[model samples]
Target: MDKLHAQRAPGRPKQNEQNIPLQEIILRQAAFLFMENGYEPVTLQQIAKICKVTKASIYYYFENKAELFTASVVFMIQLAHQSTLRYLEEKDDLRTRLEQIAKAKMMHAHVDMETMLREANPHLSEEQFGRIRKAEIDIHISLAKHFQFAMDQGSLRSGDAMFLAHAFSALVMLGSRKHVIEHNTPQEDLPQTVVDLFWDGIATQPQHRK
Candidate 1:
């Protein structure tokens, strides 16, 4: 982050120094701005103005708008990953853990996926884009192991648990992405629904025999 002193009149008080530095402050604010206005629409000048700093100061830290945008996006991605990891580590049972992982993925999907897709541009390095896909695959691998163990126990139907895991993942991605596209509902609602649907399957329980 480009460090800059408070531009406010000297009367503004030295106590302001206790807050995070201006460059870091701008990075935090930049993430929100990018999410709201998209990375392309938001200019460095605009970010500097919003953060109450000068353009030169922004340059000191980011060098250019693209670098700033990349850093902000990377920060957001890390936060999403940390949140998912935290939720996923909570459960001991394989099935239960898978459910938690699915739920966490859905909850942040709106903020993470939508923003990334909206801001994506051809000029941006695909190398950076590769990180997003790899992180997703890593998450899928972790959850797939649970399915494998469950299959070995015979608690779940036998077959290739790995295939079943992948199939379930595909189904969830479809539902989750569509839910984002169609309803635009909050992320929490649809992922939870998808998880429930997955564990139980969509078929309704048959009525009790007379």
Candidate 2:
């Protein structure tokens, strides 16, 4: 048996034996399962099986399925936020940066909120829901700050930064929908198209002749 396995006790596992990479593996697998098959259908056992660990090992890190699910979602949100930050850091104009952000979001947009909420087991409490909402707000604030910077640089039209951030986020989310993406929008062209649509608007530009 492994040293970590040998260190396990009857009731609880040894905390010191736990490793970060292993924990992250469990979280990733759990998050994938939760997104692929709704939360209600995924079990600790399933996560453990996918991670090649025991159910007790999973419980050593999480108290129950709800806790595990919450942790997985939090992990994914943090990753998405980090990716967005990286996209914003790229040396590009506001339109290019926004397109990069949209592409990043699209890559990580497998989770569906309505379906996840409906299938969530043990039903998330108000407090749990609040935590998720706060994570989202943090992302919003980060994006809003980026938008404010772009506006200051005169790259984007001046408007309420917060509202523009939310609108931009909504547009990115819209791109994630299967129906919207299935209409032969080439993968490479989709982000640019989204940016152009937002920047130029549906109405004809004054510079363009009929």
The numbered model that scores best in lDDT is 2
Off by over 4 Å in 2: 1-20, 179-186, 206-210
Q: Which runs in model 1 stand beyond 4 Å of their true positions?
A: 1-23, 92-119, 131-189, 205-210
Cα lDDT tens digits for candidate 1, 1-210: 113334322332211365776656777778778865665677888888887777876766665676677677667656655765675567566556656666665544443354555566554667656665566566556556667667778877777666766676766666656655675555555665666777777669836568
CA-lDDT, candidates in order: 0.64, 0.76
Indicate the TM-score of model 1. Answer: 0.61
lDDT string for model 2 (6-111, tens) is 5655554333355647778888889889876788778788898888888988976776788888888888778888888888888887678888888776665565
Number of clashing pairs, model 1? 0
Model number with the top TM-score: 2
The TM-scores of all predictions, comma-separated, are 0.61, 0.81
Residue pairs in clash, model 1: none
Q: Model 1, residue 53: what's the lDDT?
A: 73
